[model samples]
Target: MAQIGIYGLGTMGSALALNMAEHGFDVAVTNRESDWIAPFISEAGDLAARLHPYTTLAEFIAALTPPRVILFMIPSGAPMDAMIDEITPLLAPGDTVIDGGNADFHDTRRRTAQLAERDLHFVGMGVSGGESGARHGPSMMLGGSAHSWQQLKPVLTAIAARYEGAPCVAHLGPDGAGHFVKTVHNGIEYVDMQVIAEIYSLLRNGAALAPTEIGALFADWDRGPLKSYLVEITARLLSYTDPETGHPMVDVIKDAAGQKGTGRWTVIEALRMGQSASMIEAAVGARGWSSEKATRQRAETILGGAVGAFDGTPEVLAEAFLAARILAYAQGFRILASASEEYEWSLDPATIARIWRAGCIIRSALLDDIAAAFDQHLPQGQLILAPQIAQTLARCIPSLRQVVCSAMHGGHPVPALSAGLSWYDSMRLGHGSANIIQAQRDMFGHHGFERLGRSGRHHGPWWD
Candidate 1:
């Protein structure tokens, strides 16, 4: 096996290093401190001996073999910049450096251009599956020069989680495209999880199902077409019993949600590009509003009922929720597919389907459907719209659309969910009120608008 250097030992880097070690690669792992090194060595003994600890960036770079391959697994924004800046000066020609962190795709593009001057190859890679997935195998997204990708091929393929018949990692276009895909990958995850949470809450509170009962229901979905990580989480979440009195665990927590950044970025970017990412954006807004309980109190005091009782069993309701959840993801993912086209991202929809099939948080059996959708439309570079998916959407869109509308009527906050649902309607129907969108855009910036109602000119500037 070839030698590889990992420059940071955070959860992701450490797991990658361990995976490499297990596979008999001469993996040199380093952190900024000596203390963190011993524990890793202790836990992974034989693999430990292959580990190389370095207190400084310079030393880590110096230890690499000729035609060096060093992967930086550090924090995203600042740490990535500082490490790359420091090491780029010391690197020789043909030496490749891969940033296996969630750095911004635009940043990757700039960094790639900068590294070219020194003849030091730079690759921006997106690694998902969290820590546990990394240790076993991860879903990796590679973006950079095709030449650099070829050099890292076998090792990357060997390390990534395999699905159906494909590697989780793929050469995703040029420059920042890999990171862009990963960024949107996370955006899709946000929509997926939000829809699952909505379904679980509806089942638990609205349908009044007990915790374990729900678990059994989700377990069934695990064996069906709806099977996936999201469903598995539903099972796990429903399994937890309270520690205080050994009762059901969910009643202990408050109903508040928090987010870091990617969801917000995805929605903003999608809107800026004029793509319909309403479901994903609505999800982001719904989470933001959940933190404001006072608003919920007002809605309860003034407005009407939102989600109501389900007379169905866990099995029946589970299928309904899964079908609804499918519509939500399909809506959000469709926006992503469209945005990729508008921005010239050139994302390989098949690889994305493959990656999501195994290592990522949203891995679902639906990936098979996604794969077929991509294969069917590969020559056209079309968004996901296959016959089976259309049937699934047809089965659930009306219910989801009503669910979103009713929530809004009751003054409940639900941006992504509602938007995602609407996104499906807009794409499938194509008779959406573009006039409303154009009117709003013109109202804000006086941007020249196009009108189908009447050709050549200004359709706005009406007094409210």
Candidate 2:
């Protein structure tokens, strides 16, 4: 009998199964289409001996041992729910069902409760790293019952990406925590991508740098603190020239960026939790704003302005780039902290950082520093405000301020970068100007504002 069951055979699912087979674990896979089985088995080649392809769900479930682990890599929402409904009857009392999709946390929480009614364990496991990572080693964030973790740990940890000999898989908490963390991961990813784009825009439009030159800069940065998959890929993207026209491939590609709702969901969750994830929120808004290509084109023609040459240097911009990224992570972790408290999940921010150190799209050397920072400082304080992080930001602030000012002067829309700076400044402010707004509220409406020396709320007269 197979030790584990894979209930989908999509790119990620097949890759996951292949990973398991390569790691010397027994895996049984079934897909919606029966024809896929033979091809998948054939593709396994030498690994086929450890892999089983079942055309039927019954045989697949039967192939697993007692207290079986079945992971679903299907689409989220209604399809995931439908799959659960179809498989619930086949599952034994203690059997586990894992959703390895970009599911809404609310749905995961509901499904966990629903599955518990029948004594079946429901796990919302967040598996990151694209197809290649799935086939090799992916970062896994598991949230569910301890029983489910006990059953699934060996397989998950075996196939998970490792950083300095530590597996990238962890049992985060109960119910929807895994999916929630994944959602925030995507949110941070959105901001990271946006911040990179803003830097590219500043380099290209503001400094009038050639694509190759910009690509070289990114490649050099990749060797430095900005080393990560996204930056590496971006460097490659910039360096590519179309065979037909010899123009940069990125120039030939469509300008619009596509999103899959995880970022938006994160913004919504942050708002509901009363946390300020402004950089992420701005990134989501920027994508929506990017989708209006026609409007942008028309507006550009109608309202044109001559921009002066950028007074900023690449070194200064790089400093600003890193600082913006620091703020982005700060915003993401802050949201996570608030969500953990509100949901009562007891999430370890350090572990989250460590898991993100590899496999995941947002994996970076900064995450290693974040993990260390969390270890040194208590979770009660902001990650950016941690002594070491704060000192670094202090050094970068001058350059970041210059970059933001230059971007504004050059008429470039660096929303994520601007928001990051704003968030940083707002947090550092000893007394903000919002008190005037509070006084305004007390003047018109009865929403009270407390006096500086007093504790209780007091009404104020604006004309006095």
Task: List RMSD in Å for every model shown.
Answer: 3.7, 1.5
lDDT of 1 by residue, 25-117 (tens): 777677876678768778887787777766676777777787789888878788777887778777899888898888777788888888888
Candidate 2 residue lDDT tens string, 213-248: 999999999998888889998998898899999898
Q: Rate the local accuracy (lDDT) of all candidates.
A: 0.73, 0.91
Q: Model 2 residue 175 lDDT?
A: 98
**Superposed Cα deviation of residue 434, candidate 2 (Å):** 1.6
Between which residue pairs do clashes occur in model 2? none
Best by TM-score: 2
Q: TM-score for candidate 1, please give it.
A: 0.87
TM-score (C-alpha, index-matched) for candidate 2: 0.97
lDDT of 1: 0.73
Error of 1 at 201 (Å): 1.4
